[model samples]
Target: MKIFLATGNKNKIEEIKKIFSMENTEILSIKDGIDIPEVVEDGNTFEENSKKKALEIAKFTNMITIADDSGICVEALNGAPGVYSARYAGEHATDEENNKKLIANLQGIENRKAKFVCVITLAKPTGETYSFTGEVHGEIIDEPRGEYGFGYDPYFYIEEYGQTTAEMKDLKNQISHRARALAELKKNIDEILK
Candidate 1:
């Protein structure tokens, strides 16, 4: 069966593909020749955005589609960048800009607690959908670290891992929020594929 991942982010696609590797099923993405307009993520929460993207793409392509809305929410910021994490600095802000803004916003704050949240939605062409969520707790560091991963990875430090998400390159796919969410989705793969 063909499973379409409704996202243009190559990094996300790669992470998801690695987690969802399975027999007899092919994971495909926007780069796989399926052209669909970007779905507006105006939802108040990750679950809403994930479901909207998955359902829209599944219906558009008449194929089962998977989509996720993931972001880092800082405790000190009161989750200011929750759903707006992608455009925290501006609508067209780059990762560096966003990271800078995040740091600036946290100035003088002592509590650096934060968590990365991921909500995944699996949608069928018929509108049937299932949702799963995962989160990874960490602290936001003022200085960025590592040379891998994307977005807030460099600033998200896991104490237990003793490294930032970006630094845990080889171990990311095994313990990331996205990885945990996909693992939950994988548990129901048989029913989803049927």
Candidate 2:
């Protein structure tokens, strides 16, 4: 079976591909000449956005489509940048821009408590859907670190791992929020497909 991954982010594609390395399904992306309008992600929550993207893409492709919404939620920021992680700095913000804004916003604040969250949704052309959510608790550092991973991974410090998500490539793949959500989805793939 072929599945459509409703995203244009190559970084996310690579990570998700790793999780599904053993699967027999072929994962297709928007970069494969599949023309579609840009998805407007104005939902209030991750699940909402995931559902919106999955359903829309599934309908457009008439195939099983999987979409995930992920972001970093800081306790002190009252979960701000939760759904707007991609554009935290601006409408067309880059990772570095968003990180800089986050640092500026939290300057002089001692509370670094934060968490990364991911909600993955699977949708069929029939409109039926399944969603899974996962989170990784950690602290945010003043400056970014590491060169691996994407988004806020460079600044997300996992105390237990004693390194940022970007710093621990192998560990992040196993314990990150997106990884956990993908793991859950994999565990129930049969039911979801059935």
TM-score of every candidate relative to the true structure = 0.98, 0.97
Query: Number of clashing residue pairs in every model?
Result: 0, 0
Q: What does candidate 1's lDDT look like per residue over 144-193, in tens digits?
A: 99988899999999999999999997798999999999999999978876
* Segments in model 1 whose C-alpha atoms lie over 4 Å from true places: none
lDDT tens digits, residues 27-108, model 2? 8887678876688998999999999999998999998999999999999999989999999999999999999999999999
Worst 10 residues of 2 by lDDT: 16-25
